[model samples]
Target: MEGDCLSCMKYLMFIFNFFIFLGGSFLLGVGVWVLLDPLGFREIVAANPLLFTGVYVVLASGGVLFLLGFLGCCGAIRENRLLLLSFFMLILFIFLAELAAAILAFLFREHLTREYFSRELKRHYQGHNSSDVFTSTWNAVMTTFDCCGVNGPEDFEDSLFRLLSPRTMVPEACCQSNGFPGDVSVEQCVSGSATFRRNKGCYSATVDYFETLLFSAGALLIVVLTIEIFAMVFAMCLFRGIQ
Candidate 1:
């Protein structure tokens, strides 16, 4: 038992290192792929404009944090003197980059916001080109780039792609049976006239804002946790590489 326990402890030490690197890898992948919000289509832009923009910013920052944390963790597991030293320097640069971006976002957010609002209003009135309901889903796209301190980046493109992504919806039968607001409506004696508001694959301000808020919060969590996971994974990989 004593020998087994000792062996287990030794194994745990290595396992933990592997876990560290695993976490780092996972976070890195998620940071790159699982991102949404400013890049997603929740119709938050035309719906609540500024409110939705804030949510998108928060969600994006969360992903950035995960990426940072994972990088740091990967450096932690490095025993190679050169690798360790390089990571030390890299982490500092990453931190500075983040700080600079934060400052820029803070300063530019207000100036750009007024124009941003106007554009959103326009989109709202126009209703997102007949294809999208609540028509202004694209306004938040600009808002996101402004907040991110970039004019035209892949981030902007990704945001648009997310909008065109397929959406999940309840079946017409289910919606009608449960009296959900869907395409089909029934006219019953007690209910009189039931109308399912015509939604052209777009949500109104209330729906968009609420949905974006929830998704934004979810994205934040995923990013933050993913970073920690990356850190753990990176640590493990580093240790194993040396062994």
Candidate 2:
């Protein structure tokens, strides 16, 4: 009975680690795709320091998961105490790191307010004509989301964009039209026309976008963490049962 239970535990460990291996491969593929995408993804990520850092984090996480999965599989199959212990230690370290990160995020949540982002936008945002990365990124964001400044057109009142281009109330990306081309004249957009200017702010649109992304990522994270816990438990059990 004891031998049968040990065999069962060993197989369970293998199955769980195999799943983790597949998940890690998927994450690694995604990270590589984003990094090497021929489209505008690389450019967009490069434009933002935070986004660039996130890409690297994704890559590192994928690599670590891949390594952990391999270690778990090998340790279980060979019933190697050293490998099992290493796997447990690594998982514990990652679990503790995640906890620390979560605590820090919660502590700093209040600082990530709209007012803070608005101030940053006002300080660094150049006009539409500027070819800088920040300007281009904002143009792309505004165009993609069909929204204007952080809090709408009013936010640009004292912006550098307004100071630089006094005649233009908002970027051309903020304009909306009913025509085929859908490109309303900038004059109409700036003439206080309600239909021409998009009333929605980029802040809310960005929040919604990130919320959707985070929901998906959070689900995946929970699954991965659960698998890790199971892997750790099975690894320790098998390690102890081994002769």
TM-score of 1: 0.35
Give the per-residue lDDT digits (tens) of candidate 1, residues 55-104: 44544554554454444434443345355345445444544554575576
Best by TM-score: 2
> Model 1 lDDT vs. the true structure?
0.39
Each prediction's RMSD to truth? 13.5, 3.2
Candidates' C-alpha lDDT: 0.39, 0.78
The digit string of per-residue lDDT tens for model 2 on 87-157 reads 98997787677667567657866556778667867877887678888878777778777788878888888
Local lDDT at 9 for model 1: 36
Per-model TM values vs. the true structure: 0.35, 0.83
